[model samples]
Target: MTKLRIGIVGCGSITKYRHAPEYAHNDAVEIVAFCDPNVERATLMAEEYGGKVYADYLEMFHNEELDAVSVCTPNLYHAPISIAAARAGFHVLCEKPMAASEADALRMIAAAKDSGVILMVGHNQRLMPAHQKAKEVLLVGDLGKVLTFRTAFGHPGPESWSADGKESWFFQKDIAIVGAMGDLGVHKADLIRWLLDDEVVEISAFVETLHKEDTEVDDNAICIMRMGKGSIGTLTASWTYYKGEDNSTLLYCENGVIKIGTDPVDQVIVERTDGTIDKYDVGAMSTNTGQTHSGVIDSFIYSILTNTPPAITGEDGMKSLKVILAALESAASKTLVSIH
Candidate 1:
């Protein structure tokens, strides 16, 4: 477990923003290779992150003795790249919206299982300090019972974050698959499932393309989910926030209400039935807002080194993907979809 060798595929905005910088600082990781279809981007990342650049990911995988790889490509490529990495004897840390479809996600899971390599999804919200605390509280039955909840993940649009701006692959439905719902919704799906400690049993949704001109994907989505134990929730993913990012969640229970990433100072706050308030300063999730770290890369490396299971397993990722796909199907058919 001495400085695990790593490779990064698809050197896009996520690589530059989270993976590269985070890996650069981690003492346990050595970024050994970088790959992207764009040679210039791959070369720049290699210069900064101390990795060999390659235009083809398969070539990088063949040449490097990588123990793990981060699949940061478009939604469609997630499955193929992850499956290939798993087969190549490298653990994979794939970005959210694990695949364009559930069938693809299941195939990725099967590949990882068959290859006997770790498969961790980059659902960083579950790694957030506030979120971790919330899960702890809920597991201890402090919330009494999560009867209903509402969570939202939104921002101006990919143009604000994408290196390619509006022309990014994220705007193309053929690649990104489901737009805002795929980009933002899947993260919430994973987080809420973990936080509530429940499975989504049903979904009804409205996945739409209402804003952001010249895009083949949706800009906003509203999904209603019925979870196990009769608990239910609303999930909103949007690229039309226009003003700023809103990655917040509110859980209403029999005894209290939990809020995370909602207020300025109190990052995690609990308000009881008697109006007593408890506030915690657990920091943030990503480096974008105020520089708190995501524990995704760290945990992925730990799992690989220790021969332990990752927090977000391939099956867990598939379950989250199922919710999103079901929502999209529900939107298209105008009916409540049952999660089998």
Candidate 2:
């Protein structure tokens, strides 16, 4: 079997903990090149993963023979690197918050379309075992129509998780675009949209730099959204949850409620109106502290090998990004923003 050749851009914490190790474990993939401005980081990854290190992604693209590339760079670089890879005829699996702006994301989609290569976004929340089970229950109509929902993703900031610690690009407005919203909020947005199988049509938000000092980007955000299917909800993303990580979602339905990630043993809990309850130990979610195989790499490889559309396509990413962008606008103007 001819293995799929992989090239990884950006040797940051995400690449180190998630992308590199996941790729290494896949028998179908051979990581051929690694690129990062910090040549030392790239070299270190190359030494572990058996790849040639390059300081520039463009140089790596020019030199290596790769079947796919993972765009694991800061939020700002997602567009350029993914676009370049697509144009070079390589499938791209880019990290979330797909690009700094919706326009750039559209261009990336166009590039992949023209190049006839797969372009997938790394929204691993949809692939979480709990989330998958929740979706399954919802699809069965056992919970009735979803009425209202609340989803939150909070952590004790990225300093401890990022490769650069306090100096990570996550705190830079220029690079990260938005702090908590981009880092954590976007994931929830994507997940909710998928879980409900609905789009957020309207949104009002309060996005502010509340806790972290010296960061231009927001540290917290709260968005009130109305889904196209008439379900209303609140999405909160925060970096000041000093207690521990909170990645949970609650869906209120016509017949009952479904809670996800609330219990340690039972990841998904379903409660019906008649006082019946069901618990599922679907498996653990991948957290910053307890990392697990995200299943994103496996799905991406499956799509390529089987010649199928990615589980999360670029269009799916753009729709989710629109929600975050709308939230930002709503924050600045202090008004509700509607997604078209």
Candidate 3:
């Protein structure tokens, strides 16, 4: 079997903990190159992963022959790097908040289409066992119509998770674009959209830098969203969740409610209007403190090997990004923003 050659851009905490290890575990992939502006980081990854290090992604693209590339850089670099990789004929698995803007995301989609390569977004929330189970339960129609929902993704901030710690690009408005909203909110947005199989038609939000000091971007955000299917919900993303991580979602339906990521033993809980409850111990969710296999890398590789559309396509990414962008607009205008 000719293994898929992989090139990884940005040797940050995500690459270290998620992308690199996941790719390494896959028998179908061979990581061929690593690129980061911080050459030391690239070098360290290369030493473990058996790849050549480059300070520039373009240089890596020029030097190495790769089948796919993971864009793990800060939010601002996603579009440009993914575009370059796609145009170079490499499949892309870009980190969430696909790009700084919707326009850049569309350009990335265009680049991938023109190059005939897959472009997958790293919205691993959709791949979580509990989330998948929840979607399955919804699809079964046993829960009846989903009326209201609430999803949250919060942690102690990226300072503890990023490679640069306190100096991480996550705090920089120029690089991160939106702090908690981009880092955590986008994941919930993507997850909710996928779970409900509906788009957010309208949104109103309060995005502010509430807790973290010295950050140019927001530390917390609360968004009220109305899905196209008429379901209303709230999405919360916060960096001030200093005690522990909270990645949970609740969907209230006519029948009862479905809760996800709430119980450690039972990751997915379903309650019926008849006052009966069921629990699923699929697995634990991946958190900053307790990392689990995200299943994103394997799915990306499956799409490449099978020549199928990625589970999370660039279009899906763009749609999810639009929600966060709309939330930002709603925050700034102090009014409801509608998604077209």
TM-scores of all predicted structures? 0.97, 0.99, 0.99
Q: Model 3: how far is 21 from its true place, Å? A: 0.5
Tell me which of candidates 1 and 2 scores higher on TM-score: 2
| Candidate 1 similarity to native, TM-score | 0.97
For model 2, name the residue pairs that clash.
none
Runs of candidate 1 with Cα error greater than 4 angstroms are 285-291
lDDT of 3 at 97: 92
lDDT tens readout by residue for model 3, 29-124: 999999999999999999998988999999899888999999999999999999999999999999999999999999999999999999999999
- Compose the digit string of candidate 1's lDDT tens values, residues 70-108: 999998899999999999999999998888788888899
Where model 3 places Cα greater than 4 Å from the true spot, the runs are: none
Worst 10 residues of 2 by lDDT: 56-65
RMSD of each: 1.3, 0.6, 0.6
Q: After superposition, how far is residue 230 of candidate 3 from its true place, in Å?
A: 0.3
Error of 2 at 14 (Å): 0.7
Error of 2 at 11 (Å): 0.4
